[model samples]
Target chain A: MIDKEQVHRVAHLARLELQPEEETQFEGQLNSILEYFEQLSELNTEDVAPTTRAIDVSNITRIDQLKSSPNREEILDCAPEREGDFFRVPKIMGEG
Target chain B: MVSIRDLHQQLINKDRSAIEIAQEALQRTKELEPKLRSFLRLTEEHALAQAKQVDAKISAGEDIGLLAGIPIGIKDNMCTQGIPTTCGSKILENFIPPFESTVTGRLAESGAVMVGKTNLDEFAMGSSTENSAYQVTANPWDLDRVPGGSSGGSAAAVAGGQCVVSLGSDTGGSIRQPAGLCGVVGLKPTYGLVSRYGLVAYASSLDQIGPFSRSVEDTAILLGAIAGYDPQDSTSLKVDVPDYTQYLKPDLKGVKVGVITETFGEGLDDEVKGVVETAIAQLKELGAEIQEISCPRFRYGLPTYYIIAPSEASANLARYDGVKYGFRKPDSNNLINMYTQTRAEGFGAEVKRRIMIGTYALSAGYYDAYYLKAQKVRTLIKQDFEAAFESVDVLVCPTSPTTAFKAGEKTDDPLSMYLSDLMTIPVNLAGLPGLSLPCGFDQKGLPIGLQIIGNVLREDQVLHTAYAYEQATQWHEKQPSL
Candidate 1:
């Protein structure tokens, strides 16, 4: 079962701020989702080998060749805030 | 009446001009645009100009490319040079792509006239078109109901006959589910079969572009045009793409078809199940052997997909800071506030929720428990197909649990919205090729799609079998009375 504290914790970890009402709502919803996932635990996966891929395909990387790309100015032109060659924004970390 | 082959015949016979078709398609778009809302942007002037070139080529007795002058719809997620590539998000409202995606470039080279970019769920994140920041695209079948999304507009355009075909990207049923709801053919080709260069990434590992068409032959023709190696998409396969249209004969004499047992559990409505069962019976009559197969790992597909998809989404969406290639807030005093306010104001609620969930799953301590663990689980799901495919050439199931639900019904419930793709998720997780085509309709007359999944790079066999069934049945001939 999920609690208000767990909801708050998950939300914070996700970088989302949740209100008290949201925490209550999430507690019930997350628990319902968790309860559904519990059905997966009953399967006998002990002797079963974990399969990673259906296709045996590998080496899908394309060659590193220089191609004409959108200009840096065109790319940076849409930035919400800019400082020369870099995007500028509020300080995310503590005072520097 | 305008099949790809027939259009080719017309172009070859000099009876009908490609310019006329383009002009007619443009006029039809003008009539339907306000009511359907399928397109986010239409490029009629450029389209007609391209059509004129194709017509001149025909007039001069010069060879034309396949899909020459065939009008098609492109999903908004695909980057079109000089066209807005919004991905149904307000964040990039004014952003126009300066470069063309490899897929779009290939289609353009083939002389396919793109009518416009179609609407979709925001960031291709939701199942219903209701999440679109621009406008809601209605199901052509029933106007009040949704055209299942994030490729809803693509499906609706094809189903509504706005275009003979359209392009869509499927990351966990984005293409197939919408097609299923709209009564059209949608193929989510094998992973890496088509280039992903400028197709906006939703869940990078799971996303691949495919075609939505009214017939399996049209789907194969489009697939042939788009499926090839590109130096731009790092994940694109380097293998030779076989011409899929040549393999459309309705004869699967000795083929083996497996019906996955796990997909038809308690969730599917009875009407949908009945339609699928009837299709299986018809396939048996067509000289193909059918069997019931169990892949126990499929049960875990939704959970694993939810974890991996959101985790990837969280990382991919991190680039949309207000300062870089998306919407920004003018009143922001500082950098952090700029990012926060821009994202908060720019992205829709669904996009933010997914980012948050994805962020949580990939967080420092939680990565091993959630993201890593889900990847490990994804391995098991892929293995399920590996073992099952060993005994069968292909697997078949219902594409979705039910037909199109009302647009806003599940938007409020994210988990229920996620369930809309339960059957198709495993195929994406396994990276196998899957196709969804109209098999029959539910009691309410909405389309029921039969999903045919084959081993990777076996799209030819998948299409062949589906085309065979589609020809044997009258289902594909039924069009929505819009």
Candidate 2:
């Protein structure tokens, strides 16, 4: 049913650290969910192309034009953190 | 007491100033906010200013849009320039957008006044508005029960009489489910009928910006204003945007309405089934032909939807890193921590859960097994509609399994929450249009929504069927006791 290793792997992939409290609950939940998904394994889709979009569209493009977008200041105004013209965030690479 | 048609008359006769109507709506919002919590942010100043501008235009004999002064609640997912487009998530609590979405921009251009941004599930991922990081929008009818989400606030706003209409995004029944729960008219147009330029993506292929209103006519009026081909949304179809309002009063004679026999079976509340069956009988009396249609693939709608929707959600939500817009974390030594901590702290539980599931589904070995497989199953579900529509003009079912439950009733149970949209998700998967209309009430007096499903571009039939049903029933006439 619920695979602890899969749950751990999923947590790692999603970048979420599951506390002990959540792990027990998630183990059962994720397994039940996977069991539901296993139902789809029965469907015959050897010839079907995956329907990525609901409607069919071909050559959906617009003329490339350099239209003036919101200025940099206006764009960055909504950012939670900023430095000069760029958005400032935690130094994601090296220790400061 | 006034439909949009009559309201237009009152406006034309100068019996009501746009400012007067707007102030009335704002006053109602103030009165209802304590109980309903329908709005995340109310744009009273902006709304009144827009109303005065409309009055000025009318006085100057300048042509005004049909909905020029009507106050409408916009679900928070649709970005409004200079307004916080939170999408009911804490991560974007202070994240105001610099640009308005195409749908909102279209409505603004067409003279629809924005009352405020309404609440929704975090990223429109849940059925109950309880998942909203900010607040839960109470159904105007009961005040204790939920207004179905992620468009709960929009539906509650319309149902509560705070606004004449509202805009909502439907991803796996967000619009229709809330509309059903709230006892109002909600339409999720064919996936590409309305542009998705500014509406925050939950499940890209399934998401659509639609209308929530008190009447079918109001829904049509609003849909007409917003529906059009937009080059901004690559997925938006270039197909002709029909004058949807023209189909408001279509001939119902010979209209083939199909009843999904399975939707009335187990899992549906007895009261809801009774209401849907009664609505069908009334539709049959309205000179429309009724037939029993079976869609077997609908049984797997949930599993297929979960896989495909989350897979897309995983890819779509990748933009919200600490480096870009919205919330960012503090100094971190590495990129992985930056991504993980920022997302973990910023996103709410439901969003994190979905992201986790999506990431897992798209991961290396699981990609073909989960995500790719789901897409294949999605086609079979779509084909089910293709075959069923051949014999029917529109498929009919209960919009939800039941009326709105108490707000906290299903919040802890994610599976129960997922099942809330069981009936509505298939239509989205098939890329067909569906509408939820007030058909009847339960024994507890809670409103029930009868769903009308139509083949691709058969919105005309859907609206007309709903209109005929509304015309024959007095259910929609009853409002909240407040």
Candidate with maximal DockQ? 2
Cα error, candidate 1, residue B21 (Å):
1.2
Among all candidates shown, the one with the greatest TM-score: 2
**Model 2 C-alpha lDDT per residue in residues B366-476, reported as the tens digit of each score:** 888888888888888898899998898999999999899997898777878899999999889988899999998998889999999998887888999898888888988
Regions of candidate 1 where Cα sits further than 4 Å from its true position: A1-31, A43-73, A81-96
Clashing pairs in 1: A51-B379, A52-B379, A79-B323, A80-B323, A89-B335, A90-B334, A90-B335, A90-B336
Q: List the residue pairs that clash in candidate 2.
A: none
Q: State the C-alpha lDDT per candidate.
A: 0.84, 0.86
- Provide DockQ values for all models, in the order shown: 0.38, 0.62
| Candidate 1 residue B220 C-alpha distance from true site, Å | 0.7
DockQ of 2: 0.62
